[model samples]
Target: ALLGQQETNLSDGSQQRVTQLLKTAEPGGLYGAAGDLSDALPYRDRPGGLRAIAQVHDRYILAEQPDGLCLIEQHIAHERVLYERLNDRWQLVPLTTPVVLEGLNEKQLEQFERLGLAPEEFGPNRWAIRQAPEPLRDRDDLPDALLELSLGGNLDTAQVAIACRTAIRNGTPLDLATLQTLLDDWQRTRNPRTCPHGRPICLTLSESSLARFFRRSWVVGKSHGI
Candidate 1:
């Protein structure tokens, strides 16, 4: 099949390498022949099957996976982590100063309280949050969070709002240790592919893709006969 408009004009040497790469790129071989961690991911492989190289643009976590490279959006990854935690454990912590959330109607406040927000009437058009989910206790965007929850009446949506508010925001520089910890926790989650909003958290670039970009032949094994 034709690759694309740009690929049709490759030089003879580049075309040869591309052909070699395509022939060696096998399908359904991600985890190798055994299709198990034993063969696919050896003991000496990078921890968690990947290593955090850097924080790109202070928002995404640039990591190197065993088979390729990946970029993880920090905010969404943390949000997914927090959402699962809140959903399963339902942990709550008291706020030292009750958070006053404005722009919520009385009925909305009632719904918020039912969803574990623990908000009480503070003043006109505002509610004081005595206790919040552990994830939300440190967030300063309570108003926005409350607003996100106000529109929904289900527990699932409430969890999303709490997670979004609690997760580390974009542009916040994370140290290598912290980034690794976050990625480690993220890898353990039941569903780490997407966030609460259904946004992809990780973008992967396979080794084959890299080879194609560099116009180099990709060898299947460690053999160096060529």
Candidate 2:
């Protein structure tokens, strides 16, 4: 099988290390094998299995798995993780310093109310938000990505919007430890492939595919499952 062109080509030496990693990469069971694992994931026998290599364009995380390599869009992956967290425990709490929204149309105002933002009119064209969903608190952008979801008029819009805003942006830099933690949370999400807004979050290049691409004889079977 051919890996997507977007798949990063790692060194054969890295591939060899991944082969060694397969011996330790635990299966992703009901919860997750790496859920409580520490950040020291680059070592040969560390838990969680995926060996994070480096960032691709500061947007995607490149990790060596037992298969081959997995490129994960950090922002969308975090969105899925946050969305599930919010869906499981949606909570509204008062902001330490209230957020104020200005120039909100009636629809925007109504949407805030519906989402339990507790917006109160402070003055003309301004509403002070005393309380908001914990996921949305301190967020600079209101979940403005909700146009399509709101048109559907479903409650799921709330979680999706907040998750998108709270999630790590594509350009953010993440260390290996942080990358491993993010992957851990991402693995535990109900849907790991797509974010709440329906964007793909993960991509994989199987070891077999990499071998074929490199036109080399590859052996050893292990799954550093991501």
Which one is best on lDDT?
Answer: 1
Per-residue CA lDDT of candidate 1, range 150-176, in tens? 676688877887788788999999999
What is candidate 1's CA lDDT for residue 157?
Answer: 75
Candidate 2 lDDT over residue span 1-226, tens digit each: 1223213655588886874454233222212553211222222343366667888888998888765677789999899988898888988888787766667787766776677665788998877877767766665553344332233344577778678778899889889889888877777666665678665565666676568777665323434444
Query: Which runs in model 2 stand beyond 4 Å of their true positions?
Result: 1-47, 140-153, 217-226
**Model 1, stretches more than 4 Å misplaced?**
1-47, 99-106, 116-128, 218-226
The TM-score leader among the candidates is: 1
Report how far off residue 5 is in candidate 2 (Å): 20
